[model samples]
Target: MSSPKVQLRLNGIRKSFPGKEAATQVLDGLTFDIHERDFVSIIGPSGCGKTTVFNIIAGLVDPDDGVMLYRGQEVESLRGRVGYMMQKDLLFPWRTVLDNVLLGLETKGIDPKRALDTAREYLSTFGLSGFENSYPKMLSGGMRQRVALIRTLVLDPDILLLDEPFSALDYQTRLYLEGILMEAVETFHKTVILVTHDIDEAVALSKRVVVLSQRPARVKAVHDIALNEHSPIAARSDPRFSGYFHTLCAELDIQTRKSA
Candidate 1:
């Protein structure tokens, strides 16, 4: 099968935050390419600026230098092209489950009736039909994430930037949500760029995994996962899984120590 087209490109991207003493460089010459409908994970240490890169891609922050391109067209800002979900679910406390899902559509001036219709369909697909009128505080971590994912998809963005969306969940719940997220991404034909710290999660959910070097993060290694088993949990059984995890850990350890 042919590979997907390059949907987004980052070349020599750099970002720094001003400090009282000196500038704190977060990303230095950060470069990567994300293909259409591809699930790519960026993994690195805690302070490696993985999320900073996502912020730049989503136009939440502009890079200090280098090019950001979409479909080979250079973009000054991707405000309308990308949908970003942070590590926190950040669901509006007062909005009903249905309302929260429709919030983006509401913001985008979509018809209310149409948004409601679409949200109900997604609620069923999300296995959240019975809780349409429920509040965020009443839902579990996994359920809230499901709602958050649905909310992001409701807008139909070109690229989905997931910054550790599953980090807050428990072990079993995380595994379950991975399956749900994979299904949702495929259902929407989305090009997902996931910023995560979990090596196993990255290997299981991604078509390619990009490891970053320490602060002033840059792409250290990109491993294209090849496994016949089609599910995140199933991929754990593959003999190659352990090797990938070990290598990723070793690379991360080296980066951490080098920075220290």
Candidate 2:
């Protein structure tokens, strides 16, 4: 049998930003890869440059040194190949829900009527059919995030970079969306790289977890998640789940903190 194809690769990525005194290095020669149709979660300490990695992959920020390859060729930018979603919904207040979701296809020179039709179909699928005419402010936090996701998914990019996209939502909503996200990935065959702080969320949504170190973040470990139950909520009951969670917390220094 043949091995899975590599969808993306980050080689020797180095990045830094101006600090109060001098440049503060965020990523120091970090390297990683994402296989096709994978759901990979990235976990690390705060300020460890996890978002920086997402930015580089999404073409929002350039690294000082590194090579990013989509497929076999070096990618100049991920403008069309990647879709990015952040913690904040960042939806337009003026645009209606359907109009907002159509933003991606519209930018790609797709026909206006066609984009609207496609966006409508997605809205219907995601249970926002009746809310298409509603504005961003009218929707709940969870609803807004769903719209944001639909906007990204409408473009049907090869990969998706989700940066704590569910962090701001309530626990129940977060869990609900995690299941939906998994279903979306499965149905769309999307290769996703998610940056998140929640260990359980990572374990629930990702097939593999990439753990990064402190400042100048580098890969510390990668764990393949093998859950006894398939669903995110059901996976919690799996005896092995807590072990994976504990191992991750240990790596991220979560378990070592002394009591105040």
Candidate 3:
């Protein structure tokens, strides 16, 4: 037997919803492969089905066409294998930070005592040690997002699906969270797929950036981002960063117009 492998594969995945008079196609023949430990970003214009791509991957919605394979096998359900962090933190107001983070484990029927210990371990690792008992309302926006991330991480999912996880924060907070996310993904060696409209964020964090076209989206381009510093925080100021940013932005603009 070989070592356990983890990866997500998509082949000709498609989705459609009822439109005003007909089925409104969202994703059309979208195909991609996310490697076992790759940090990937998906960038596209508004209404380009970027989130739909993620929704299908998460099994929150079924694809009307094609296959989604996990580790070379078809993914029949997404109950425990995928950890999703949405735009909103979505923490329950009543639960303390630690309890919120342990929700996944509790759902899995992990003993509350053991799960609490595990959640604490993640909090400490992610720079969230002391806030375990604090309510979600007590933390800053950045801190709350950090707890949200810990909530996902504590579940030990092989892949993380981030849907514009930083779009709601201020510029400074977003930058800080980028650093934190980069560190977490690197340290844990987790496969991540981040969906965002921010070209700079895509270029800043992804090993490869996937760009999609407008509504009824399809893959327009795939770019391998080369940076001297692999860390998102340090890579921002590297002399070569802006060149990649401009190239991606230009491609996005061209695609947006072509689809328009």
Candidate 4:
């Protein structure tokens, strides 16, 4: 009967650092809301504080002002509610792929046997079933990333914060994994927020894209993507798709020019 609750909310958030002359603010008064199961991407120029926004959302970095709320309530505890995947795979060289996937559960004291059952069930879908016992050093870049993704998924968090998770992979591999990851996200119905520089990547995988300005970043634009209407490959070639990309790019350029 009432308005749906926001899964995540950032209000008047700011982050600053001391510079030689004066304090430099990376994010200034940025505020936004992410609804439950929403696939949102944050895109901006380099040094735009996109990752800083993710860190604040993940409770890794405290904001200098304002508050972050999870589910209409202030998030005082974030131990098991948020899962983060960074650009690097961050897998342990000594542990096997399956063991790495179950690492989150180990921290939570979940039973090994139960965790294995859950981890194994999703391994085939992630293209890492046969390599369960293989060490991270033995796998390719894409495979290591799969392990990292599964490791985060194994945590079963309410929200997933992805910081350019596929930026390290080749273009072809990155494109392929986007489908796999999106399928997994659909299967799990995860509330995801991604930070990416690639406009096409943002359009392909996100329901909405949030564009921000340079350091002391603020929202510049919000783009809603509807790729389900077209195949990922085909969608990029669509005229409307390119139109949106250019529009966002133009907005970013304008902001950069203003700052300069």
Q: Which candidate leads in lDDT?
A: 2
**lDDT of each residue in 176-228, candidate 4, tens digit only:** 77877877788898989999988778876777889898788998778877664
Name the runs in model 4 displaced over 4 angstroms. Answer: 1-5, 237-239, 254-260
- Which window of ten consecutive residues has the lowest lDDT sum in model 1? 251-260
Runs of candidate 3 exceeding 4 Å displacement:
1-6, 254-260
Name the best candidate (by TM-score): 2
Whose lDDT is higher: candidate 2's or candidate 3's? 2
lDDT of each residue in 1-260, candidate 3, tens digit only: 57434488888988899888999999999988788798889998898898887788777888899888888888754647778998999998999998899889999999888997899899998888888899999999999999999898888888899999999999999998998888888788889999998888888898889989888999999898878676767788888788888888887774433443
The alpha-carbon lDDT assigned to residue 136 of candidate 4 equals 96
TM-score ranking from best candidate downward: 2, 1, 3, 4
Model 2 spans with C-alpha error above 4 angstroms:
228-230, 256-260
Model 3 clash pairs?
A: none
TM-score of each: 0.94, 0.95, 0.92, 0.91
* Model 2 residue pairs with clashes: none
Number of backbone collisions per candidate, in order? 0, 0, 0, 0
Comparing 1 with 3 on TM-score, the higher-scoring candidate is 1
Q: Residue 21 in model 2: shift from native, Å? A: 1.5
Q: At residue 214, what lDDT does model 3 achieve? A: 85
